[model samples]
Target: MVRARVLRGVDLDVPAGRLTAVVGRPEAGKTTLLNCVGGLERPDRGTVHIGADRITGLGDSALTRLRRDRIGFVFATCSLFPTLSVEQNIRIGAELAGRRTEKQWFTTVVELLGLSLLLRTRPSALTAEQRQRVACARAFLNRPDLVLADEPAGELDRMEAAALLGFLRMWVRKLGQSVLLATRDPFVAAHADRVFVLAQGRITGEVERPTVESVMAAM
Candidate 1:
């Protein structure tokens, strides 16, 4: 059996109230890094921390609780429940955590994501952009300490991707949310406050206040 080291000596931080990004090509361990940080996968060495909590050695139950309470996730796939309305899908996270969705927060999230009119609509009835907006709304509804977005705009058209990234930036600036986004696209990485370039499971460079040209150069 051959054991593959997916991530090697990768050390980075997602600062509070800021959007950080990891830029990497496929098979460069971007998803693996996110999984480890999100506590879905345990690393062979080192530690993971979110705020004051050390998640590295936490039991499954503890990790689950921590993730539920502090972490939000947005992925390439919208992952909305086809059976549920947009509003229902957005509120499901809080429901699962045994927490009631705050009405004001819900309203704000829906409005910001332009999902207000689509609240009663099912996922299957919406456009791809709309569904992804619902996904974003759901992820933000909890106001988690950190959001992990893996290739979140991969499925969107250029304009749609720009819009989504703009909203993410707005959340960081307005709501003071922290985001860690992973992507292979320089355009995506350019939206981040700080961008880490990953190659062959290692962080090869970092660009602060990245632009597309800068990120491309780093890559």
Candidate 2:
């Protein structure tokens, strides 16, 4: 038995300790591309490799395990357990992956995201920005090799979006982790170390040290 690939001949590389942005208009297959990279959707052609593992060839169970252990994902929507305290929610990823949270790293991430004071609060009690930060914490708490974020700042205001992007970039550099962020906003793409422009299901161009103008031009 075989499964058909969902994507065409798309090639991408997210370098370690760098934040790469995939920018495109809505319905331009940005989510689909991100999903394939995260192993949520398999491409019909090409391969997706995270670190040393070629994830595209793995079976469902293996892919699931690999994603759980080596990758983290943050989406546009807030994903949180309303009844769970922030600390409990943040630790869920490590627990599910059969790993323990490293105290120092956890502390560092919490402080970096300004989540220390909100540790005891539930998701329902937090502001939109705070909840999103908590989601970021959960994604990074396990210290995964790579993180895939799909429009993570879509719900935020301009200032909050800028802050979130800054936080994401800082953490990627500090932890030497790779990140693939998908977005339609040039403002958001400008925060990336490099940006790839996608259009009509294909990569149209690449921009280095992207600015809003550069990213828009690339698109």
Candidate 3:
């Protein structure tokens, strides 16, 4: 018989309107943590909450609707539709959430991400960083209560990654949106307001006002 546990008694809290980071190596169950919090995975034990909603025990349809209504996700890969124009890609996010697009907010997000000129372009026509920004725009356009980004800049070069993280930090602060970002990079964690270091299947430590050196030590 074999028993495998991907996460063990994981406990974490992401405060409202703040950027929180989960710092760990690639296989440290960071993604599992995010999935559980996002209600994409059920925890064997323990509660998961987003705002006031207890998500761990939610049924599938309810979880789906909750995620669509209250959370936005940005994946490590640029998960944009190759066939859709950048403008269309963003609009789809609102449409999927049963929202009417708010023009001012949409324009502001596009401009902040430096995508104002690329709205007519397809994902195939954009650079890797640009594609990621489009994905960010889509995630944030609906103004969900929480945003979960799983190694969002993992594929970018150092400069590109920094640029993307900087944009994320700035906009999250500006909009007062809560965020939980999972990454292995100490540099990335440094941008977060708080960092939790995860090892094996559990959270080992945390740092507030994180510096790269502090995160490295915790990890």
Candidate 4:
């Protein structure tokens, strides 16, 4: 059997209350890195820390608890339950964690994401952008310590993608949330406070306060 190593010596920090991005082409180990950090996949070696707790060697149950209480995720696909209304979908995160949803925060997230009018609608009824907003709102509703977004705006059109990125930026700046977004798009990378360029399973370069041109150059 051949063992493939996807990420090699990738060390980076996601500061609190900021948006950090990893930009890379397809098969550059971007998704693998996120999975390891999020505790969905355990690395062969290395450490992952969330706040003061080291999660690298934790057991499955411990990792589950950590994820439930501290981490949020936004994937390329807006993975909402088709049977549930948007409001139900958003609330389900809290429900699964056995936590009560704070009414004020819930309302705030809904309004900020422009989903107030669509709460009662099911995921299938939404446009691509609207469904993604619902996903964003659900991820932020808990105010998790860290949010991992993997190609979150990958399927949206230019205008929709920009709007989605703007909302992500607003949450980080105004609400003191931390986000680590992984994408192949330079435009998406530009929205981050700092960008890490990945290639062939390694971080090749970094650009602080990245512009689209700067990120493209780094790539």
Candidate 5:
């Protein structure tokens, strides 16, 4: 295995309004790459640009602004406040983006995520699937330019994964939001318009979907 690097000169472009799936086996440096791009971690080499803004080189405060104002993330873990209601969690994101007064945007995200019925429920009261959906809704509530999701469906069963992936596809298409998702599951990649296969921190191949059985076989 190659020794870890801060950044490994991997260049990627995620166009607007597209869902790009990044697939790699265990320990393929998926989270590292995401952290660099998301401005959560600084890279030793190379630059990460979200449109014209270079995220990798930004100072801590600037990176925080970039992430909060322009990007969103969904992790495998539920990072929402346990004490806050689902709607409040979602609303906070919008508030940060200065859109808290926009009822239309709030209602749109809630309706799209089917969270109207669960608005009052706290994170502790929700099931895993419901919590994940709320996470999704919270990420979209701010209308971010890009979203980065790591291992989003790793814990869900096949049926639930399919449903969640489909909702992500719809979210990308209808909201004009771009997404980069990292997963090991072929089913998750099946929902993306394109897939990049990573191995030992290098992109070994690219596959376009709806994938053929032969394409899935390669993974």
Candidate 6:
């Protein structure tokens, strides 16, 4: 594997079932940290373990399979196949995991995201917020080991952003899955259970139960 040499003597253990905010300024290496955690990038000096499995040493095929089966992503831009309906778009996650969609999981996701009625609609027919909501539903549908979101709400309006954050909080509380979200937004970072502020490729500070006031002062 081509290990990504980013974490130099850096150490952080994310507790299960919590929303972890990786926050820092531009080029602060927040995205790189998320990539490493999600196995999109391997750590050169340290191993990444998801439970008992050492992810950093996995072969390409093994890593690919691990990512497909155990992780989900929400990029800064909403990545979806516009030609596919909302249902089919969401289906792609489970399909990649090589698991037939669980009916209960799919139904719960659609209802939680209010996408059941829009399942037949195309991506172009929806607003940006709607499109992102579909993406969220898809990511959660598979019950992944970890969810990595890079600026997932960066494009939304204030109200939409708040709603998105609340939705993520609910996921953490209800689904019991860990989420690693990287963003530059102070308000968004405020919602996390723990906030790690990176600077010059190192974690400069940390705030437990992050808030806009606390995180801003750290930055």
Best lDDT among the predictions, by candidate number: 4
Query: Roughly what TM-score does model 2 have, to 2 decimal places?
Result: 0.93
User: How accurate locally is residue 24 in candidate 5, as Cα lDDT from 0 to 100?
Assistant: 79
Residue lDDT tens for model 2, 1-219: 885333456677888889999999998889999888888887777788887778888899998887787788888876888878999999987877777777898899899999999899888988877888988888888778888899999999999998888889888777777888999999999999999998878888999999999999998
Q: What is the TM-score of each candidate against the true structure?
A: 0.97, 0.93, 0.95, 0.98, 0.93, 0.93
* Clashes (candidate 4): 0
Poorly placed runs, candidate 6 (over 4 Å): 1-7
- The residue pairs in collision within model 3 are none
Deviation (Å) of 93 in candidate 5: 2.3
RMSD to truth, every model:
1.0, 2.5, 1.5, 0.9, 2.3, 2.3
lDDT of 5 by residue, 25-133 (tens): 8788788888887888887877888888767667888987878877888888767889889988877766665654478777888888888999999899987777888
Candidate 1 per-residue C-alpha lDDT over 20-118 given as tens digits, one digit per residue, 9 for 90 to 100? 999999999999999999988999998888988889999999988877878888889848888888888998878888888878878989998998899
Model 1 is weakest, by summed lDDT over 10 consecutive residues, at: 64-73
Better candidate by TM-score, 1 or 5: 1
- After the best TM-score superposition of candidate 1, give how far the Cα of residue 109 lies from its true spot, in angstroms: 0.9
Off by more than 4 A, model 4: none
lDDT per residue (tens digit) for residues 116-196 in model 6: 899999999998888888888878888888888899888998899888888888999998978889999888899899998
Query: How displaced is residue 33 in candidate 1, in Å?
Result: 0.6
- Regions more than 4 Å wrong, model 1: none
Global local distance difference test of model 1:
0.91
| Whole-model lDDT values for every prediction | 0.91, 0.87, 0.89, 0.92, 0.81, 0.84
Clashing pairs in 5: none
Kindly list the per-residue Cα lDDT of model 4 for residues 1-219, writing each as its tens digit: 998999989988889999999999999999999999888999999899999989999999999887877888888885899999999998877898788987888889999999999999989989988888888898898889999998999999889999999999999999999999999999999999999999999999999999999999999
